[model samples]
Target: MALHFSRDEFASRLELVKARMKEEKLDALLIFAQESMYWLTGYDTFGYCFFQCLVVKADGQMVLMTRSADLRQARHTSIIEDIRIWVDRTNADPAQDLKNLLMDLDLLGSKIGVEYDTHGLTGLNARRLDHQLTSFGTSTDASYIISKLRLVKSAAEIEYAEKAAALSDDALDAALRLAKPGANEADILAAMQGAIFAGGGDYPSNEFIIGSGADALLCRYKAGRRNLDAVDQLTLEWAGVYAHYHAPMMRTVIVGTPNDRQKELYAASRDAIEAIETVLITGNTFGTVFDTHARIMDERGLAKHRLNACGYSVGARFSPSWMEHQMFHAGNPEPILPGMTLFVHMIIMDSETGTAMTLGQTYLITDGPVKSLSRHSLDLISV
Candidate 1:
């Protein structure tokens, strides 16, 4: 098997899940999150876009129900021994197939937990699952069980996270070399991604955010590309992925001489992020971090330009997004724990002045102090 984690590590993870399941009175878990399945059984695939479920019984028994295309994929990449294939055809009901699997496992009348909040489980499929399970078993939305467990990184996961961080720094180095005036956005993006790949990194969970000129104010990835102006700004947000562990970084580079507004924004961003660093500790909650960012930005009179959310937890994830469930937003009660990898960002976009400034980096939360993953300095880049 092409398992990234040791069998013992996988076993430990499974035990943790079972413990949580027991605590929640869940007799079985219909895990639909790809990240959950991969963490539990070393099953890795993008096939989760379709209907697929990993059924885990409280007794430590596990079964996977997926399409035929992933039969060998599971065999090769996962530790799952009991794999069941659901035929894919016109009007095929994989939910029914899942129900059959549950019946076979004698879980028909059991209290099951379903991981419904994920990209892996589409709304249509979720409705199908609920419909199929009606009167068969009691189901509860326990989506956060595995996610909460995954918030703290294990030693092996931390190793991968550190490697990802190194690759992130490398990508920034490559991007900075080509971010000068007249540089093509596409070329800069290619160089950045290339650096990660060259450093033995894996493909990120989502597309890198790359925009220049007026589009620099955009935080999301868009379709087109353009060359850098003689005096322009480039906003980049990218993650270096290694073994599915992510270390993300963001920056809004000033292509030429930065204007007064840009400088002020950058300074505010830097100050806010630094303030956040002091609170990203074991005692502080995710909400506290955001409050610190908001306070600094609002005090600097840039509240309108600041984003509501500061950042989020980063970890092994699938396509569609890299952000974990825990985020730095107002009033979030999620505690900041040791061994958690978090990306803290300060994004300030001023549309009126047509200026953008963003600064972000991933950190490993420890008992003593948070450790920066990226080796790159936080100083504003002007190329």
Candidate 2:
């Protein structure tokens, strides 16, 4: 088996899920989230755009239902032994096939937990699945069950995260070195991505968020290219993926001397991150950390420029977004725990001045002071 972790590790993860299933009185878990499958059985594949399901029974048995193309993929990357293939046709109902498989397992009329909040399980497929299970079994939304279980990092997982963090620092260094007046934004992006691949890193869950001037104020990535301004600001946010685990980093680069307002915002962002770090310990609620970050920025009169939340959980993931369901949002009552990895970014954008300053890095919560994953300096870079 070409599993990422040892057999014992995989077994431990399975037991964790089964324990949760027993607590919830679920007979089986119909997993549609690609990340959940990867975490449980080392099942790695980008073919989740098509219909797929990994069924985990309460007793410990596991089965995968996917297209014929992914049958080999399951064997090569996962520990799942019972693989069933559904044929492709003009009008194929994989959901029906899943129901048939459940019936074969004698789990019909039993309570089955389904992951409803993922791209792998689209609304159409979910509706079809519900219709198919109407007569076979019961399906309930248990998306957060597996997700919450994955928040705490194992030793082996932390190794991958550290490697990813190193690659992120390297990529950001390349970006800062290549970012200068007259440099093309696209070329700068190319340099950073190249640095990642050259350092043996994999593609991130989302495209690198790279922008300059007014575009920097916006958070998401957009197409097109423009030369760097002689005295402009550039913002970048990207992650390094190692064995599907991600450690993201963010920074805002100044090509020349920044204005007074920009300097003030950058200082506040730096101080806010430092202050927030002091409170990231086991037993503290995430809401408290977020509130501390907000108060620091709000007290600096940058409330409108700052974001509502500062960070979220990071882990092995697939496309669209790297953010896990666990987040550091105001009023959230979830308590921080050891082994949790969070990417906190102090993003401040003065829309009127068209200035953006973001300083962020990943951290691992320990028993005492949190450990920073990236070695990059927290100060805003000025070239």
Candidate 3:
């Protein structure tokens, strides 16, 4: 098997899940999140776009119900032994197949925990699942069970995260080398992604955010690429992924010399980020970090240019997004625990002056003090 973690580590993870299940009085857990499956059993596949489920019973028994296409995929990549394939046909009902699997496992009339909040379980498929299993037993929305468990990184997971951080630094180096006047956004993007791949990194869960000129104010990835102007700004937000663990970084680079507004924005961003770092400790909550960022930015009279949320947790994830459920937003009570990997960003986009400045990096939360994952300097880059 092409397992990324040791069998003992997988077993320990499974035990943690079961312990949480016991606390919640869940007889079985209907895991639909692809990341949860991979974390538990090294089950890797994109076949989760369809109807698939990994059933984890309280007794430590496990079974995977998936399409025939992923039968070998699970066998090769995962440690799951009892794999059942549901046939595909016109109007196939994999939910019914899942019900049968539950029956075979003697889990009928049992309280089950369902991972309802994930891209792996589409709305249509979720409706079908509810329809088939509604009367089977009690099902509760326990989506956060595995996600909360994954918030803290293990030693093995930290190794991958550190490697990902190195790749992120490499990507930034490549981007800076080409970030000059008349440079193509496409080429800069290519060089950045190429650096990650060439450094033995994996594809990120989401597309890298790249934009230049007036579009530099955009935080999301959009279509069309343009050449850098003699005096322009380029915004980039990307992650380095290794073994599915992510270490994301963001920056708005200046082509040629930075203007007055650009310099002011950069200073505010740097100040806010450094201030946020002070409270990124064990006692502070996620909301505390954001409040610090907000206080600094608002005091500097840049509240209008700042985003609502400063940053979020980053770790092993599937396609469509890299952000974890826990985020650094106002009123969030999630504690800042040690062994957690978080991405903190200070983004300032002034459309009034058409200027953009962003500074971000990933950090590992510790008991004493938070540690930055990236080795690159936070100084503003102007090429």
Mind giving the per-residue lDDT tens digits that candidate 3 earns over 1-383? Answer: 79889999999999999999999999999999999999999999889999999999998899999988999999999999999999999989899999999999998999999999999999999899999888999989999999999999999999999999999999999999998999999999999999999999999999999999889999999999999989889999999999999999999998888888988999999988888889999989999999999999999899999999999998899989999999999999999999999999989999999999999999999888789999998899988
lDDT per residue as tens, model 1, 126-224: 999999999799999999999999999999999999999999999999998888888899999999999999999999999999999889999999999
Give the worst 10-residue stretch by lDDT in candidate 1: 368-377
Best by lDDT: 3
For model 2, the stretches where C-alpha displacement exceeds 4 angstroms are none
Which portions of model 1 show Cα errors greater than 4 Å?
A: none
lDDT of 2 by residue, 42-107 (tens): 998998989999999999999999999999999999999999999999899999999999999999
Instruction: Write down the worst ten-residue block by lDDT for model 2.
Output: 374-383
User: What residue pairs clash in candidate 2, if any at all?
Assistant: none
TM-score order of candidates, best first?
A: 1, 3, 2
Error of 1 at 379 (Å): 0.4
Instruction: State candidate 2's TM-score.
Output: 0.98
Q: What's the lDDT of the predicted structure labeled candidate 3?
A: 0.94
Preferred candidate (lDDT higher): 1 or 3: 3
Candidate 1, residue 265: the lDDT equals 92
